[model samples]
Target chain A: MAQNPNRPISPHLQIYRWGPHMAVSIFHRATGFVMATAGMLTLLWWLASIAGGPESYATFQSYVVSGGEEATGMQVAINWFFRLLALGVTYSFFQHMFSGIRHLLMDLGAGYELKTVRTWSIAVYIAALTATALVAMLVAARFMGA
Target chain B: MGNGTKLGRVRGLGSAKHGGKHWLDQRLTAVGNLLLTTWLVLSLLWLPNFDYETVAAWLAQPSVAVPMILMLANIFWHVRLGLQVLIEDYVHDEGNKFATLTLLNFYVIGGAAFGIFMVAKHAFTGAPA
Candidate 1:
C-alpha cells in the first residue's frame, strides 16, 4: 500500500471543543494505561513478596505500610510519598472501573444520546469518588482500631 | 480492467474481517473485570487486618484463591487487549508496533502466570511461616 503523506487528519484536541464525554473518554484511556503499568507492577510485587517468605514480605510491608520506627526525616518523607502514590492508585482503580462500566454500557447499545452521555460521564466520576471515599474510610477505621 | 466500482473496492479493502472478534473480546473482558474487581475491593475491605500474615491467610482460602486466580487472568487479558489497541493507534512504525505488541504479550502472560502461581502456592501449602 502506498502511503499518503498529504492525507487529511481527523480533528483532535486542538481542533475539537472540550466536553465532559471527551474528558471521560480520555481519562478512560489514561487510567487504563496507568493501571496496566503501575498498578499491575504493584500487584506483582505484593504477590511476589508474599511468596518470598516473611523476611521479604516484611521488607515490602515496611515500604508499603510503614516507614520503620527508627527512620530519619527523609525516610519519613519518602514513606509519605509512597503512601500518596498508593492512594492515587486506589483512586485510579475506582475511576477506571466506573469508566469501563460506562463504556460497556455504550457498547451494549445504550447511552448514545448526547444528554445521556453527558449525564453518565458525570455520574461515573461521582460514583468513583464515592467508592474511593468509602474505601479510604474503611481502611482508616480498620487501621485506627475503630 | 476490473468490473468492480471504486466504492466496492474501498469497501472490500476496509473490511479486515477480524476486527469484530477483537472488539468483542475487549468488551467481554471488561465485563469480567468489572465483576471481579468489585469482589476484590469488597473482600479487601472486609478483611480484619491488612498485615502480611492476615492478608496471606485470607488469600489462602480455596474460596478466595479461586476467584483471585480468575481475576488475575481477566485483568491481564483486559490489560493486553487495551494496550494492543493503544499500540495500534499511536505507534506509527510497523516494526515498532509489532515489537511493542509482542513484548506486551510477554509481559501480560508472564505477570499473570507469576500471579497465579503465587496464589496457587498459598492455596495449596498455606501461607509461608
Candidate 2:
C-alpha cells in the first residue's frame, strides 16, 4: 500500500510535553517492576528464612538489619545497602498501591475529566509518600517504645 | 473481500479472542493485590515486634498462613500478567518475545511455589496454636 512519507505521525515520549499523568503512569509500571523483582525476592527470602528456623532468620536479620555487633566493614556496608534497598521497596510499594487505586477509580468510570484526573494523579504521589511516612512513624514508635 | 460474510472476513483479526480475557484478569488481580497487600501491612504493623520469633509465630497461625499464601499466589499471577503485557509491548521480535515470556513464567512460578511452600511449612510446624 502507498503511504505519504510527510504525513504527521503520532507524537511519542520525547515529542510530547511531560505531564504529571504521564510521569505517574510510567512510575506505576516501573515501581511495579521493582516490587515484582527486588521486593518479591526479599519477601521470599524472609519467608524461607523463617521456615529455616531461628538461626537462619537471625542470619537474615544480621545481614539485612543489625549488621551484627562484631560487624566487619564489608558487612556494615552490605547491611546498609540492603536497608536502603528495603526502603526503596517500601516507597515503591506505596507508590504502586496509590497509583493502582487511581487506576481502579478510573476503571469504575470516575475521574475521567482532564482536571479531575490531573488532580488525582498528583494526589497519588502525595498519598503514597504520606502513607509511607505514617508507616515509618508507626514502626519507629513501636521499636522505640519497647 | 474473500467471498465471505463480514464476520468471517474480520474473524481472528482483532482482539485475537484472548486479549479481553487477559485484560480482565489483570484488573481482577489488581483488586486482589490491593486488598491482600493492605491486610499484610496492617497485620505486620499490628504485631508487637519484628524479630524472628515474633514474625515466625505470626505466620504460624492458620489464619495468617492462608491469607499469606493467597496473597503470594495472587501477586505472582498479577506480576506475570503485567510483565507479559510489558514484554508484548517492548519485545518486538517474535523469538525474543517468546523467550522472555517463557522465562518470565518460569521465574514467577518458581518464586510463588517456594514462597507458598515456606509459608505452609511455618504454618504446620513452627508454633503451637
By lDDT, who's the top model here?
Answer: 2
lDDT of 1 at A15: 88
**Residue runs of model 1 more than 4 Å from their true location after superposition:** A1-5, A144-146, B1-11
Worst 10 residues of 1 chain B by lDDT: B1-10
Question: Candidate 2 docking category?
Answer: medium
Expressed as tens digits, the lDDT of each residue in B42-80 for candidate 2 is 898888888877888889988899999999999999999
Give candidate 2's whole-model lDDT. Answer: 0.88
Tell me the spans in candidate 2 whose CA falls farther than 4 Å from its real position: A1-12, A144-146, B1-12
Reference-based TM-score of each model: 0.90, 0.89
**TM-score of decoy 1:** 0.90
For model 2 the local lDDT of residue B114 reads 97
Candidate with maximal TM-score: 1
Worst window of 10 by summed lDDT in candidate 2 chain A: A1-10
Please, what are the lDDT tens digits per residue for candidate 2 over residues A56-76?
A: 998888888776679999889
Q: Report how far residue A81 has shifted in candidate 2, in Å.
A: 1.5
Q: Tell me the whole-model lDDT of each prediction, alpha carbons only.
A: 0.84, 0.88
- Alpha-carbon error at A32 in model 2, in Å? 0.3
